[model samples]
Target chain A: MTIAYAYGPNPWPQSFWDARAAANFVCGGAGAGLVVAAALSGARGTALVVPLLAGLAIVACGLAAVFAEIGRPLRAANVVRNPATSWMTREAIVAPLLFACGVAGAFGSLAFVATAAALALAFVYCQGRMVHAARGIPAWRAPQVPWLFVATGMAEGLGLWLALAAFLELRSARVAGWLGVAIIARYVIFRIYRRGLGRALAAAPARALDAAGRALLWGGTLAPLVLLAIAAAVRTQPWAPWLLLAAGLCAALFGAWLKATLVLRAGHTQGYTLPALPVRGTRA
Target chain B: MTRWAMVADLRRCVGCQTCTAACRHANATPPGVQWRRVLDVEVGEFPDVKRVFLPVGCQHCDEPPCLDVCPTTATRKRDDGIVTVDYDLCLGCGYCAVACPYQARHRTPRAVFAYGGAPAKHEAKRHDPARIAVATKCTFCVERIDSGTAQGLTPGVDPEATPACVNSCLSGALAFGDLDDPGSNVSQLLRENRHFRMHAELGTGPGFYYLWDKALPEAAQ
Candidate 1:
């Protein structure tokens, strides 16, 4: 049957073209820089404050990008009001509250309480749900999306703080331990997403997406591993954190790029279906 | 409840896309915006394959994650089961877009203009342009329903009873009616067909139903 359907408006503005491009560069690049800075630093008071502030800034900028992409800005606050069931709502609530907690902890106002650890965890979880809620995009909807996002956030946070310690000429094996953990996480997520890509590769269209993912997993992730090995071998050299910092930066960029590429390549499919057995129909 | 549903018969559907065009015209939706889309999927390799056309849109589910994840409560499912989005209340957060398992929602950009012939420009009005930035999808013509009922006409139908798409359909493949109605064609079709919802593993429980062609090629089998 020739059925009728409706169309809606595209909400983008002329200015959005420039704004989005800028946002991608700054958020994607500067965000990685901040993480590297923090990871090279010590677990001192300054180490906590700078990364906390930078993390908050990252979230704000991320929200701005989201707003720019959406045509509406005023209704952004409403998501928090409906937090009972909405992951978006939950994200809105959790992002700020965690930021507030992190700020308080960094400033030493909430040091005695368990607020810091809780906020850090909350931050990670919120980051995860942002991608997990999209049921339509199978790549984003994978069970591993949340784990990947949260783990990356934590790893980035740790890498940034540790990088700061090294840059500041402070000593801490804890920083190396953290970088090690982040590398491991990046590897694990890459594996999981690889499996998902295999499932998605039924169509020829998904080849580019698969390739982008592979690039990030190999070049971006392995870059840090080489740096880490060098640092471990020459323990006396103070540049180990710097090398780890570079690796962290690459990992964040390549990972986010892989995600964005995969998301953009996604085409809306026939509604989610169970495995269907084909019937002998018309021939090509 | 207003549970919105549709049934498409593979045997009858000609894949002309009358529904797609009518929907665009009725809504005056800008270019690049299709409230409904038909996916032409070709399955199998070489001699083993066949083509199938599938129409998709919002399923208005029983457990709507879109509504659940909308922090602003901008998106909601009516008691009658029709899911509607309040554009003015939307924050353009993209959270709904991400949360929707069906990937039904799209985040509108900050500015909107009519497109087709050329890039038409719009003068700024009093309302914030950000209102359009919110997530959007098919509202099932609720405005038509409200106005139609007020005028003593059945919404989505006439004495001959048909929706725009159903009325325009040349092959009589599209069927729409209350799934709860025992006499409804949609209900009968559902009972008769070996149908399924996409990605049941996601547990979205969408209202749209698909009847696959028994003659589909090896890949789609």
Candidate 2:
């Protein structure tokens, strides 16, 4: 008889960590894009429904990331005890509450609540950054982390709609109208935070910070500008929205990929060894 | 209510995993279950780099996040603010682990036994299999403390009075005490050092604190 001798359990596999990290980063990037796009302009009627739906999607993805990392996904709700002290706790309390706010705002047509949902969207960004902060990884130390994430959420939402419009062949001048706005907002964010991001990219002190800074600028700012130009040109041409939407999709996808790659690579740069001591604890 | 806390003298810690092992034994944790661990990290570079060994575990925070996301009310905070997990009520859900910033919680694939000197005896002493599939972590040796207190071993000491890990520190690196008491060593250390928790910016408001010497070349800011 083969007995499953449950003496000791094994540590979680690398695959688990890898999958969680990849999914989290993608959702985070997309969520950032969405939130920014939603806030960039005012949406009325079912048009408003787009941002709300996007917000709900982001929340779902965030919950999935959380649930996937845990040992028990179902027991996920117990973390609401000290909103005053914990972000994870605050997220637990706020996520559903925020979702409820979105629902109430959507159904009741309350502008104030929709504004509140936008603010809550900012909190969701904070929660995502909070996870990275815990790992003690230097790459996560950026003050713009919250801003970057929120922006990306907005951008992702805009990209989704743009792509959807292209697929549906919908020719609302308003839809074509917002393309430049998304590009400008995304590019501005890149310039602000990523102008001199990394040493290798910036050609300076070779500090990881320098490399990260430059990468953010190029990947976030420069690359998107190129894509946006292509997209804008396509917007003016007949039957070009479809192509522009395709181009936007590529830009968003590549933009997210490049950004995540830089962040992950920066995390790996922190693996340098510490100085040795005669004993362990005391500092020399 | 005495709020228990720990202080590690960075001057003496030897990077040993004795505390980790002791915690496992004391808690009767299963395999792949580590309530405490020794993390060896490198800081700085070249000739100036320094190795720092931090023995980390659940901070048993004044504000425990694990207690927050538990849908089943499986985790709770003691009156003194030490966090404890109820394995029986835990539905093997991993929410609390994610909420924990310290990455302190360990969910074993199955129930485990604290092997005595003899493996057979250890298996015999293991908590019954009927009670498997629950979340758990160090409870500050609550059972031992209660018993020890009754026996006058110490004012608040219990059967597991002194946490096994604290006792196992060969270099006297770890110290535990009531943070609420001004006379307690933990409180005194807090008063003396401008230490910071791992992710202070997140506002987890962790009870665990680290004090690094300013003069140290390799200390992380």
The model with the greatest DockQ is 1
Off by over 4 Å in 1: A1-42, A110-114, A201-223, A238-284, B40-51, B101-103, B106-131, B147-162, B212-221
For model 2, the stretches where C-alpha displacement exceeds 4 angstroms are A1-18, A21-25, A28-69, A77-142, A172-220, A230-236, A258-284, B10-16, B39-54, B61-81, B86-103, B109-137, B155-160, B170-173, B179-221
Predicted structure with the largest TM-score when compared to the true one: 1
Per-residue lDDT tens digits of candidate 1, residues B49-76? Answer: 7666666667777777787777778788
A136: Cα error in model 2, Å: 5.0
lDDT of 2: 0.55
Worst 10 residues of 2 chain B by lDDT: B212-221
- Determine which window of 10 residues in candidate 2 chain A has minimal summed lDDT: A6-15
lDDT of 2 by residue, A1-284 (tens): 11122111111111112345545556645653454344444555565556656656765685687466555545555455445444555556656666666666656766645564465665547555554343323334345555555555455556665665565454434533454455456556645555434421222223444554455456544565565566566667766676556545654665565445434444321221212233433433
lDDT of 2 by residue, B150-171 (tens): 6666422222466677778887
Q: Output DockQ, candidate 2.
A: 0.18
What's the TM-score of chain B for every model shown?
0.82, 0.83
TM-score for each candidate, following the candidate numbering: 0.77, 0.65
Docking class of 1: acceptable
